[model samples]
Target: MFRKIRILLLLVVLLFVALGTWRSDSRLASWAYVTRVAVYPVAADDSPTTAQFIRELDAASFAAIENWLQREVKRYRQTQQASVQIRLGAEIKTLPPGLPNAPNTLDIMLWSLKLRWWAYRQEDGENIKPHIQIFVLFHDAKRHVGAALPHSIGMRKGKIGVIHAFASPEQTGQNAVIITHELLHLFGATDKYDFATLQPVYPQGYAEPERLPLLPQTLAEIMGGRIPVSRERAEIPKDLSVTRIGPTTAEEIGLLAP
Candidate 1:
């Protein structure tokens, strides 16, 4: 009886802690503030080339990401202008490739908790605490890679995420798009693409749904796929330069006037 009681008490404590963290995260996401994001680069593949690329990663590599976010934030004139500032965090050399690749939602949550603990241990006392943490896992192109399942969780304690991408320099722009996509996920933005077809949904997924031609959209919605070539066909944007935030996405992320 005593053991059961203790277990119940522990569960209650955990529930309270989770509630508190959720409330805090909600305020941060809703408020008009500069979100400080820490980007950690990890070599997911064991290839020497991937290791070399990770070694050479610097702040300059992510310049386009920052520029893209800054431009999007400025475009929203109604709401308090919020901006995202990303800093290259320390390189994680010990993390394995399958750490965050879980089989189910429960397992994913557990992995996120483990990652949060690991990140806390990696930080030095002088480093500022990040509002969001993103781990960019670079895989070697020489090996045949499968689909990426980049994800994020917004919590006061576990505001950490993972993005799997290629290690080649040519993929840097695409990596930025993935990073921004996951970053918005950390702020309560939902995916605007259809899971089955991998195409951006109607209206919300379109950059300008009112365009006369409707097909072959010039600008791709940030939350949507890159290029809406046709009603049935859409492609990923070449870089962050052509990606934009649609009205629905802007409203969901608190960038639009509520």
Candidate 2:
């Protein structure tokens, strides 16, 4: 009897969250003033370098993401001077909930709900709370040596993200790219890259699709995450300067939706 009652209550809570977030999703996608983003950093691995990097972080460290969004907003001719504001939140000692190894639809949905609840509990005695909460897990590249970082994820409805990034200073530029990519996902942007090949989709993913001999494209679409340099190969963007928000991505994110 107790187990049945608990299961029923859980289902009710899930339904309530779904309905509430359905409405919140529209507002978030509308580019409203409540688009403040709070970033919380966590050391994914126990390394001295990672701890130091997190300790040294400040507003200036993420300035690239801010500058990039400001530029994109102007380029798209949005009403607000800046639709997105990135700020640091209270330090989180523990890591956010991670995804299952092979998450099915139900698993993903449950994880999303748990993630949102976890985010709410993480709020400290801050005067201003963030509308979008991004938990960045930084791994020490110097000590651990070169290894592929874990995948990052963002939720459109809940406006939360768990981003895996490197703690090395040199990787900050690329980290900004991944962070911005997940940030855009929170705002309703879809990935423009092929999951199988990890290649940027043509036309929508290409920064300049109209250019002659489109192979060796110079810039990457912000949602695409790759600069196509050959038929089967692409380059990881060095910085936000080498990335652009294509029309499709802008439209999806409500930037082009006057």
Candidate 3:
């Protein structure tokens, strides 16, 4: 009788936990309030360029992201004056755990847990926890001239993002594009591009899919990651101005009614 009672109590606790998790996710997606996103700049390498770049950073440096998001939210007819807020946090000198190359399921799971634990100890510049946390790692452009930076990843489960970016003036807009892309991922957006080819899928990936000339698209869908120029080639948008949140992406991020 004692064993049966203990099992029943455990089951009840599990059920409540599950329900609480579901409700929290639902609330975030509901978009009733502004989602606060904290951005922490990190120096990827010990280069003078990267160090100076990090030091010059301030909250206003990320206004492009806030502007783009606001326009998108209003475009979708969301009543919230501010759908999302980006506050620059203090620079983190340490690098987060790097993603394992060719990681298996178990490896990825373990890395994710470790990353979350690391993020939990971080202080959001304001000392208060934000709805989402994005750690941006900036690498010296000259240092990585020949090699590409690591891929950025965002976890919807934890609402955290680890982004790799360049510390060059020219790449500022492009950096925001990547950051915004990962930011939406935290809000439940999925990549609409094909992994094998890195091309935006049919209609979901195209910003204006109904355009008469689908090729040479003027704008790139945010989730698609690039502007489809030809059946065989695509180009990256220089900035968020050339990128847009499509209907499908809007739906996924709760900007549109499902």
Candidate 4:
């Protein structure tokens, strides 16, 4: 009789433990980060078309961002064994230009950013609310010294805008990293860009100053945070630190298991 009672007790304990684990997992998956990209149309050939440049640059930028994100998703799953899904959705069509007024442009952008966030928000949770959605905007400068601009979080609440701006399309992935860097700003991460001498900048942002490192080391290192270190004005290999998204930011988005 005692032997049978012991077996029954063991079974009950096992069931309880299983239930507890399942509940914990359910809670952890309450939030998700789904990504969708939208590209502005390519400008006409040599038309001074800001639209065309933006369209091309964003394509490259999205590719770089997606590759890095996918690798991070795999690494996070292996490390945490968490079931939370981080999905990359299909790229959507860019919105048509708004009114001619500059103020209208800002409003249009803010709304567009919200819409993108909403699309992702509807994916998992019962409530359609997301902490933030990343927006990449392309802008053409009207004058000789003009440049392209990416959407900024700062413009939203001034709380901490995570927007980025790029001058041209050829620097897509590199420009995309700026968006990644600004997004990290929301999480209180400082720029690793070394600004020591000229205007009294904080030091120690560059990780691989020599501009060379193997795969795993680059990903695991701290300096590989968001932006890559430039070597003699040239971007290092994409496979380096920029390949891995920061763990700290990933955790906040619930992409990593706690």
Best by TM-score: 2
- The local lDDT score (0 to 100) that residue 252 gets in candidate 1 is 84
Select the stronger candidate by lDDT from 1 and 4: 1
* lDDT per model vs. reference: 0.77, 0.85, 0.87, 0.41
lDDT order of candidates, best first?
3, 2, 1, 4
TM-score of 4: 0.41
Residue-level lDDT tens digits of model 3 in 148-211: 8888998877678999999988899999999999998888899999999999998999999999
Candidate 3: worst-modelled 10 consecutive residues by lDDT: 16-25
Better of 1 and 2 by lDDT: 2
Question: Per model, how many backbone clashes are there?
Answer: 1, 0, 0, 7
Query: lDDT (0-100) at residue 151 of candidate 1?
Result: 42
True-structure RMSD, every candidate: 3.1, 2.2, 3.4, 14.8
Each candidate structure's TM-score, on Cα atoms with residue i matched to residue i, is 0.85, 0.91, 0.90, 0.41
RMSD of 3: 3.4
What tens digits encode model 4's per-residue C-alpha lDDT throughout 14-102? 68746754553344343343423232232222335554554344234456555554566666665543232222223234432322346
Candidate 1 minimal-lDDT segment of 10 residues: 148-157
Judge candidate 3 at residue 205 and give its lDDT.
Answer: 95
Cα lDDT, model 2, residue 153: 90
lDDT of 1 by residue, 39-128 (tens): 888888699989999888998888788888888877875455566778888887766334444368878667666666676676633357
